[model samples]
Target: MTDPASPARPVAAAIRYLSIIVGCACLLLAAVCFAIACQVFIQTGVFAQSYVMVGLISAALGLLALTLSRVWK
Candidate 1:
């Protein structure tokens, strides 16, 4: 029988690690995007809806990545 903690499971461990890394990156990106969006809105009297859309997308992506990281492994 194959051992659950065998070295052959490196790939699975690597994938989980990758997921955590990706989740952190996504969260960072979302924060940046949100900051940029707020800055743009504050600087420009005219509201650019696209910035909001981008920020929302980034936030969603970040949330999904984080959730995946938790669910993985």
Candidate 2:
């Protein structure tokens, strides 16, 4: 019979990796949105409010993901 602890190891590792990936993706999206906001500012001399909003949301998501990853263990 297989050891009961064996299957859980891979699942936990997968969750940890997934959390890290998602966190990084969120941060990257935030950066992209922030870049767009900057471009809008440069071209129009006015802030693109929507871009700023999205960037904030992405940043929050990233932070949440990172937090979850760290705490999962």
Considering every candidate listed, which one attains the maximal TM-score?
2
- Top-scoring candidate (lDDT): 2
Residue ranges of candidate 1 with Cα displaced over 4 Å: 5-8
The stretch of ten residues in a row with the least summed lDDT in candidate 2 is 1-10
Kindly report which residue stretches of model 2 are placed more than 4 angstroms away from their true locations once superposed: 1-4
lDDT of each: 0.76, 0.92
Residue-pair clashes per candidate, as listed? 0, 0
Over 1-73, each residue of candidate 1 has an lDDT whose tens digit, in order, gives 8799888688777877787787778778777777777787789866767767776787788678778767765
lDDT string for model 2 (24-69, tens) is 9999999999999999999999989999999999999999998988
Which residue pairs clash in candidate 1? none
Q: Kindly provide the TM-score of model 2 when superposed on the true structure, using C-alpha atoms.
A: 0.87
